[model samples]
Target: MPRRNEDALNFLLERRSVSHKTLTAPVPSRAEIEVILTAGARVPDHKMLEPFRFLVLEDAALNRLGDAVADRARALGLDEDKVAKARFSFDNAPLSIAVVASLKQTDMIPEVEQTLAVGACCTSVLNAALASGWGANWITGWAAFDEPFLQDHLGLAAGEYVAGFMHIGTVRSEPSERKRPDLNAITTWVSS
Candidate 1:
């Protein structure tokens, strides 16, 4: 007989991501973050290729990121409100973890696999934060897809891209349950 971890399963079933704007201060400490990162690293990797890395943005770094986004938005002739909202994610959140997808040069493991690994890493980080009782959300807006912004600010390589920007902090409000896709409508099972 095998024992099942019901608590972990229950947590997964009921997990909800809190908004970055609704998060307050009292962010996780270095050691606490390390634990979260450790959990984040446990994502599914098809070819054992560690194709992702984390950039921990804290304190003044967040402000710098916000300013960079604003600058990029202005340069691109984007709406001020949109730019401000994008930047606000960093300004308000206590901590932001940038999950970068660094694609490896390999013919055996396709680029898609590496990209999927990066996506998995992002989810892992978000789940880890939520499970740890910290308010967390995975976010990536126009700024994340802006190549010039990424190159100028985060120094992202040509082959690399932003998987997601996960914000973590203490919760300020209780998040309401959102609608989820129906399993029967989305799932298909085949047995031959």
Candidate 2:
């Protein structure tokens, strides 16, 4: 008989991302983060091409990125409130892991698969952090897609971009469960 871990199943079934703005202090330590990252790397990769990487942001870097986001927003003619909103995620993040989707040029594996692998990596990271007892959320605003911001702030290369920012911190308040999709409405079962 195959052993099933109920706790793991329960964790997955009830997983919910904590909002970055509501996240506070008491984040995972350096050692703990290393463990989380290690766990995050375990994902499906076609052709053994590791198509993802991580960039850890803390303290000053978070603030700097926040400032850059605000600047970018302003330069784009966004109003004050909109600019502030754009930067809010970074400004409030205690610790964030930027999941960089660095794809390789290969005819064997499609670029879309590489991108999907990166997205999986992001989910793995968020799950790892949440399992480690820290509040976590995966976020990416306009700053993630801005070429100038990616190059200047994150130092991403020509083929790389941010998949998500996995923000980790302590929970100030428990988030109430939001309405979930109805299974019957969204699912189709086929049996031959």
> Per-prediction count of colliding residue pairs?
0, 0
Model 2, CA-based lDDT: 0.91
Q: Write the per-residue lDDT of candidate 1 for residues 25-143, one digit (tens) a residue.
A: 89999998998998888988877889998899998989999898888888889887988898897788799999988879988899888888888889999999999999999998888
Q: What's the distance in Å from true for residue 36, model 2? A: 1.0
Q: List TM-score per model, in order.
A: 0.95, 0.96
Scored by lDDT, the top model is 2
Candidate 2 lands at a TM-score of: 0.96
In model 2, which range of ten residues has the least summed lDDT?
A: 140-149
lDDT of 2 by residue, 1-192 (tens): 999999999999999999888899988999999999988899999998999999999999999998999998999898998898878888899999999988999999999999989988999999999999999999987778778879988899976789999999999988889999999999999997
Clashing pairs in 2: none
Error of 1 at 63 (Å): 0.4
Against the unseen true structure, what C-alpha lDDT does each candidate score?
Answer: 0.89, 0.91
Model 2 regions lying over 4 Å from their true place: none
